[model samples]
Target: MSSAQPEDGLPVRRVITADSFRALKFKLSGARPAAAPADPVSLPQPPAPQVLPQERPVLAVPVEPPAEPETVAHEPPAPLDVPEEEPPAELIVENAVAAMPEAAEPAEAEPPAEAARPEPAPEPVPETAPVVAPEPPRVEAQSSVPNAGTTAASSPSAGFIERRVVERPQPEDPEAGKRAHALLDIMAMPTVGSLPQERALANDTLLRLIPRMPLKSLRHLAERVCVMESPSQLLVRRLINDSRIEVSGPLLEQAMTVDDSDLIAVAASNNPAKLKLMARRRIISPALSEALIRSNHVETLLNLLRNPGAAFSIESMWRLTRIAAGHPVLQAPLVTRHDTPSPIAFQLFWQLPSELRRYVLSRFLTDSETISKILTMNAESDGAPRKHADHSLLSELEVTAPGEAGAIYAELAHVGRETGDRIAEDQGGEALTVALKAAGLTRAQFGAIADKRADAEALKAIFDTLSFNKARVLLTYWDWAARRTGPYARIAAA
Candidate 1:
């Protein structure tokens, strides 16, 4: 290597020689040197660096290759080819590189020309590509529900319906049952009144609970609510339609909350007993009367006729009179009803027994012209089928009066005997006269049967005043009134 001092007082460098360049390549490759040559080859040495008195002498410390780490079961690395005191050949090579001129830097040999790589054949492009809809991303959703089958989040199969298991009704809880009973009791308390909303809610709850309540509980509830000053209409309607009479009777017979529309609906049923209870309502609308009459229930019709509070339309009375033409027991009340139109009463006059006919003419018909027309119609209808006599009257007595049937018969058998006294004692003068006349006895026999002087006078006057036909009508009227006021009224009606 050669050097010069520049104007900047820095050492200038010259080209490195071939031998130094050869040594650098060998040092970098970490190759062992060949054996020394037979003749020593001398090489030019570099000039020493100058140092001032204030500067310390600079030493050219050699860089040794890094020691390969010791590894287990591995041959020890070949001993380094370096002396500890002498500078390493690699260090001299590095100094040579640092001093070399840029122009004299050895050129890297061009790599042997890579076998000419042929240009990749351009990829063929199709002239036209089919347009396809992009597929929707699939989401694999894991169902948290146990035993549930996985379903695709994308398009579901057409016509596929997903079904879940329907839960079964659970057995009623004891606590829930107790709560229901408590609610019923609370609502039933007379002193307690509910707001409309509360009452409506309570009615809905009760309707749900009704099918579960026993007949006794239902009947008791019916009794309680029927008498309430303001009862739930929904509750009243449900109870009135109950299958059991005991559960429904009070509501049908006495519940003020029961509407005429409700009664009309109930009258549509085939249940004659229900109709009878409905017949006994304090007031009945014309529509309901028509419905009851349409029932053609003989007993129900009788009760309706006996109910003075019941109003009958003209058409209803006309229909009822036609029906009464066949049911002899219906004639008395139908003809006597104040609401019975004069025309309807006149039409029914021919069908009634002699006693009821007399009662109808005396009470229902004051018009002389109407009376003459009724008599003419009666003569004309004589050729028509007569209304059947009520054989059920005695049967009804046996059923309604029970043990009293034999006494009634015995009183008719032996006049002025123990039977007559028993009759007078049990029933009053009016009753004895009715019984005698109804039994086809004369006014004289009724007098003989009368054991009390006051009864005999009053009853004789009654006997003289009322014809036999009218007495029989009174008899039927009294019988019905008794039965209505009796314990077996409902049974008889049923």
Candidate 2:
């Protein structure tokens, strides 16, 4: 090693090879060598710092991503097929012969290379398998699924499907059963691998493996997992977070029945991780929430009209509708708008009695257009759709001392929406026709809808059939009044 301070007062150090050290041994004595400079460079400012752009960040405008460093070459990994050790040719030939005795026998006259060739040709045996098997249908999918043996044709009939549940005897030796179960559990798990739909089979295998399984196995636990879904989600967080998660399905249903917002909020909280956990895991479906909301909705009156026998209550609707009133996801449900209740809502409100209807209508029906529409509809169409009611039930029930009447056109039409009490659809018209028909009220009994729709002349005749007093009021006074009020005033009167 040679180190020295030269003319510029710069110290430099040199490491010499063994040859150079031996040659310099005679000239240099045992004096202490000078220390190398902290930073050695040809130029005083340093050799441009090797211009490593990576070490120093760019001083320009900040961009989304910084520039990358230059890449250094790397060696590729060795091929996987390459074995750690190569067998001797003789040993390989010996093994090859042993593996394919038939092939070796066939080509015994030639070198083993020819025999190896014949052996490898057997790879095409799979393709030629059909010719050998003679019955392709009997061996379908044998190559891929590898002997499933299960077949649609061989499947047992309805008798097998109708078999009742049966119990099996448990192993008497509990310890032996436990070990067997544990061993079988490991083996079966590898095949099933936590697949979504393999649960039943996996559970069956699990029970079989643990021969000491309870008579009902995990049936109760399984049923609870599926059925005890939370309705409120408020208690769900607390319940699932606890070490002992014991709760009934009906209770969970009650909990989940609340608004989704409350559910999401409760789930978001740390204390109630269960709801959030279920949401994350997707165990609770979106459809379930939607169905629950729908179940609570008002349901269009038309549907009720079509199927009068189908009576559905909307009790839970209050909480669900109030909470999810503004959520866009709740649009499909027949819930009234949060800001402006819909026509059906108004109808429901109006059904609350004269005083309540008047108050609600006055408070919320502030929109003149809406009010005008409602009032006009109340006059022209009454309650029934314009078209259907005008022809079918409208004229018959229109004069029913106000409240006793069936749906009438004048009750629901308004503004430019002269849709009348007309059925929005012919099916609705057909439904009304069917109902009237089913009621056994014919054209003669209820009068033709056309007769009801007729000008003053036809309606006058209908008045003639009923009591003179009621008919007179309906005929002359009602007719004159309907005309005098400009149709709008008649609804106001009602």
Candidate 3:
């Protein structure tokens, strides 16, 4: 064993035996010393507790006491012996094996007395109990019935399921018609005297109510409101043109306030009935009659002609006469009209039916000279010459004086006779024109030549060569002749 010293060390350590060195080494390593064996006589003993063999063993966990400066001895806790809650019966049966601790000796265990008490029996239900339905809601009665006039049949009831009885309203009193008429009278009065706006409103109200009124009421209202003196021109005009003949008749016949322009416009409509009604007015202006005539309404023209108060211009009369030719219904009125021009009357005479022709002949053709003139004029204008020439009569006339007049008459007479049955085949236009000019004869005399000849072709030739004025006269005559003979006559002649 040796001892050694290191630098900065003041003392040297001595080496010991191996056992002692090992013991010291172990002490330096901070390890616990080995426990010594206990002496049997010094050991303490615990008291014994008795337990049943079949009982389950209890498992307890040991707990250590907390450290304290002053240590006190604590007695081991007495066995708790507090009874544990028993598990539910169902659980006991289901887990009887698992819930119980195993015993050392299985032969010592006891069998369960009975299977788990049978589950409690369920309560029984009765079969005779009646099923009660819920009661319906009650409605309170109304204190009083509502007035028939105040309640409407169409009004909704208060509740969705509730029913209501509605009474019908009473009819109006019997004097309702009289009351309505009186009201209408009151409304119509303002249409004349009130402001224009008020008048318009009154007129509108009257019109709205008029359609609902009876025929008698409408007539009465129309008579009172549609007069010329009234200020309601709009109402009067509406009434005048109303589609109802009764409503418009009075206004058309006597509405003096109707403007001439309005009358003309109505005439321009060519509504024969309305125009005829207007023609019956107390006084129709020439302009109005002219417009009426221009409409070419046959009945209207007849009405105007029959209206003594209506006057016509010469041109209008001529126009009316031309129109009257196609309308046999217009002939009688035309003939009877005092205002009708002599020429127009004469012209219409040929178009009159055979019965009316007598009156025309007697009235217009009083003398032989006038008869000759009319017949001659008619023939010339008609462009219808005779088929056979009467040259014997011409030869009987003495041309005592060889003057231009006598010479022209003789030449025209000769040419007319030459244009006999074969005149239509002959080119007599130039000859007829030369003869007429040389004769210095009027259109009447020229027409007579063509008429006497009985050749339409020759007449047309003569007409073509005549002056514009003479040709027009001939055209008018031809038109009259065509009408005088029926359409079949023209077709047959053709």
Candidate 4:
């Protein structure tokens, strides 16, 4: 090193010479030439350490010394004769050695470069060993850059940089979606374009298989079958009568293929859920209506009564009225039904709550006189023997009369003539109230002929307020239903 002064007169700056640098490098590297032996021959020198310019010299000094030097007697070499104007190389070398870790001194005697590559060390350079020294950290550092993937990919532990080959998802087939939709469309069109024999075979196969189908499959089939315009009759009947309402409900509600007999069979079942579904059918027949009434389920009965599509025989209405008289819940729907006879409404009147009773009276009573006149005129014009009798005289009669009046009363009691005679002989009881009211007889006239043990006042109240046309219609239905001896006949007889 040499010191020089600037013209600007700043502090002295020291400049390093090439020879001093080389001496310092050889001294710290543990490869200084061995001291001359007493013999004239010179021993081979270990390879000099090579240090990277970028790395500090302290890290490069820790290279292992050669094996031959370990056995040799040690002697400090003569110092280089530096100029008096410059700092000595020995001072720089000693300072660098002191800064190195003390633990590296034993390692200074073993040549790591020769041990790492013993095959052809004739080139005698230790640069290859130190070059690999800082490689691990360099490799680790390079991993942080984006492009380090190419270098680190060879290492198994570099999981984050691993390149995986993923197959791109194949495009979905358009026909696959179309085919899936076609499956549902095919389900709706079960019987399209088939031979009669084929259809029959298909139907028979379905009938046998449907009963054993899982509940979910059966329900799906049933829901699908019901909406088809002309679904197989056997299949429809099977599903309509399924024990599970979930399987049968859609058929009962929407299937047109279901016959009235099928519905009657459903009504006969103990399943109130099925009975309710049957009652909710559109355009229910009178027979089916009677069957539903016989079901004796309050919900079924209420559902039937509320369904405007349900057509009740006058007998069914009578039976339903008796049911409503017992179940207050059945009253409102039974009374409000448009198909329900006004006579049945009148019968159900006392059983209803105040609100319903008011509705019945207002609905059935307003047109009583006009309805009575129309009925009488229709009967008289049909050439009935009673036509010429005075309705005004009959309406005004507040007391009982005999002879001609008694004969007229007997004639009125037998309005169905032969059927009335049978009913009367069978102890007509309530039938007589209906009969007398149908004849347009007054409350007092009805009282005179009714059994003395009977509740005359209650019967009179019904007769006074009864719709005349409705009563006559009930009378006709009773006569017809009595011959059939239906459940309604028993109700009428009661």
lDDT of 4 by residue, 146-216 (tens): 44455565675775654444324444443433332233354345455545666565566555454345666
In candidate 2, position 181 carries an lDDT of 40
TM-score of each: 0.39, 0.22, 0.37, 0.40
Instruction: Using lDDT, give the best candidate's number.
Output: 4
Evaluated against the true structure, the overall lDDT of model 1 is 0.56
Q: For every model in order, what is the number of clashing pairs?
A: 2, 38, 7, 5
Q: Report the alpha-carbon TM-score of model 4 versus the true structure.
A: 0.40
Stretches of candidate 3 above 4 Å error?
Answer: 1-208, 226-228, 346-393, 396-494
* Local error of candidate 2 at residue 65 (angstroms): 92
Candidate numbers sorted by TM-score from highest down: 4, 1, 3, 2
- Per-residue lDDT of candidate 2, residues 1-494 (tens digit): 23356798544544232222222322232333334345332112211112222222211222233222222113232223223464222333333334433422211111111122222221111111111223345532222233434453355441222223344657655354345344334434543465534644544444454334332332233233334333113323323333332332222333344445544343333233233233222223443333333433333222211222222233323334343334434332333333333333332331233333333323443333554455346446435332322344444564555433323433322112122222222222222232343233445654454354434343334323333122112222222333444432333234
Candidate 3 lDDT, 261-368, residue by residue in tens: 877877777777888888889898889988887877666777788889997876777677777778878788888777765456555654666456445433542234
Q: Which prediction has the highest TM-score against the true structure?
A: 4
Total clashes for model 4: 5
Candidate 1, residues 417-448, lDDT tens digits: the string is 33333443544444455555546655554565
